[model samples]
Target: MKLNLILFFFCTLVTISWAQSPNLSKYNEEIKKIEDTVKYFEVEKINDQFYMLIGGGGNVGVFVSDKNVIMVDNKYEIIEEVLMSSLREITSNPIKYIINTHYHHDHSDGNRAFGKMGVPIISHENAKVRMQKVTQLYGGIYDFIDGFVQDKYPTEALPIITYNSKLTLSEDGEDIEMYNFGSGHTDGDSIIYFKNANIMHTGDAFVRYGYPYVDLNNGGSIKGIIEVLGSIASLANDQTVIMPGHGNLSTKQDVLDLKKSLMNLYQKTVLGLEKGLSYQEIADSIDETLAADPVMPGAELTKLNYIKSIELELNN
Candidate 1:
């Protein structure tokens, strides 16, 4: 009995240690698939000076020049080295700047990797604050998930440079402007524009995915998204090439159409609420209010998920 007890205690200790460290073979095996996906990245050249790196976590914008390169939204840390390898295929210039559009992990997770290499990161001041301080995320759908919320970012990962409204960067004969139009996807959302290229990177504020996710827990709202979309759309034209946070390259008309759809969704949702319909009921009734083109492949639940999110925020 004594020997059995000792063996049990030893097993318990080993289990506890494994759980705490989480770097054993089992854990590594589970993450190997993710690493495999990150090992291979895809690049789409927007023009001679600009390229798009996809497959990290968010779509990365690459602006290459004779002198150096600038990146927008450096996906997750897992894909850092692979992303750089892909970038080298296009330009030999070093990455001098990394502009984070928001504080979301998928968009800015790699900031630390780039920062460590002396690449200066720029973002809206609110984004920097959200990274340094803890913000309570409120929502029922996400409350059940453990480890889904972040309290704070590491000191090295925080944005080194922050701006209030707008900041302009002129390098390699390119004029890049970063603008903050209040809160849309987050309190510190930034819409970056390459002035000469007529290309805009609309972070999570504008995604190709159906029904944008508003982080109400992070100062995001459907109403705010509507307003922000209008502001960004005004800056586009027939010649504009929109590089959204996710999805394919878009034109100015696509942004406008999305704005109209969101407007319809807002009006329809309010009407459903007035009628005392349940959240799911309201979501079911608003199918016609969403955008129809470029249907989100394999994302059947995206609209419903977004509607549920809106329902949760509206009632709260």
Candidate 2:
């Protein structure tokens, strides 16, 4: 019996140690290999000073000024080094600021790496709060299925500067406006506008990713996103260039089109719910309507989640 207890104790200690720190060397090496690939990230020149870095995560807005470079969003930390290397090809200016559109990992995961370098990270107050805690994404739809868990950001990863509604920064004779019209993709979504450049980064609040994913679990709603989209459209003109959270660069008309599509889905959800239809039934109806629309893969599941979010909002 004593020998068995000793063996059990040894196994327990090993298990504890492994749990505390798992071996990730192989994982790290594999990820490095992928990151080192040249086509892992793509950069599109917006103009002389502004550019958009696509892939490796959410779209990164690179605004180069004479003094420093301001990034609208930094993708995952795993790609931080490679991302910086790509930026070096554009400008040698040091990164001055990183404005997080929201607290989602894809959009703000590099906060720790940049913040440690003394870069001032800016985000909406609510986003800062959300980042400080573990965020369970996709509402609870995947609670028993395949759920996405966003770990809590460390103090260094949290935004150093936070704004309530609107904050304007004057840099290189241009006004960079950050506005939080309300909760959309997340409670802290920021719509960034470069006044002089005539360019806008609509973060996740406005994405080209077929159907937008609302973080209903993190204070996001279909109605809120719809409203924010309209506000962003009003702020743009024919000359404005839109850099969405994901997908290719867009225009004001595209924003309006997205808004209309979401509005259509929102109305359909409401109507289905009023008629006592099940969530799946509503989603099916939505899916049929969106059959002609361009959507990302796995849109069927996305539509179900979208319908659930709208139903949640109406019920509340």
Tens digit of lDDT per residue, candidate 1, span 73-105? 987766678888898899899888999999977
Top candidate, metric lDDT: 2
List per-prediction Cα lDDT, in the order shown. Answer: 0.79, 0.82
Candidate 1, which ten residues in sequence have the lowest lDDT sum?
138-147
Give the clash count for each candidate.
0, 0
- Which portions of model 1 show Cα errors greater than 4 Å? 1-33, 134-147, 287-305
| Candidate 2 lDDT by residue in tens digits, 1-316 | 9999999999999999877653435334534654675355687997899999987668999999998999999987777887888899899999888999999877887887888778899999999999887666764322222255676788888888899999999889889999999978888999999998899999999887677778887888779999999999999998899999988899999999889988888888888889999988877776453321242446666677667767667777
Model 2, residue pairs in steric clash: none
Root-mean-square deviation of Cα positions for candidate 2 versus the true structure, in angstroms: 4.4
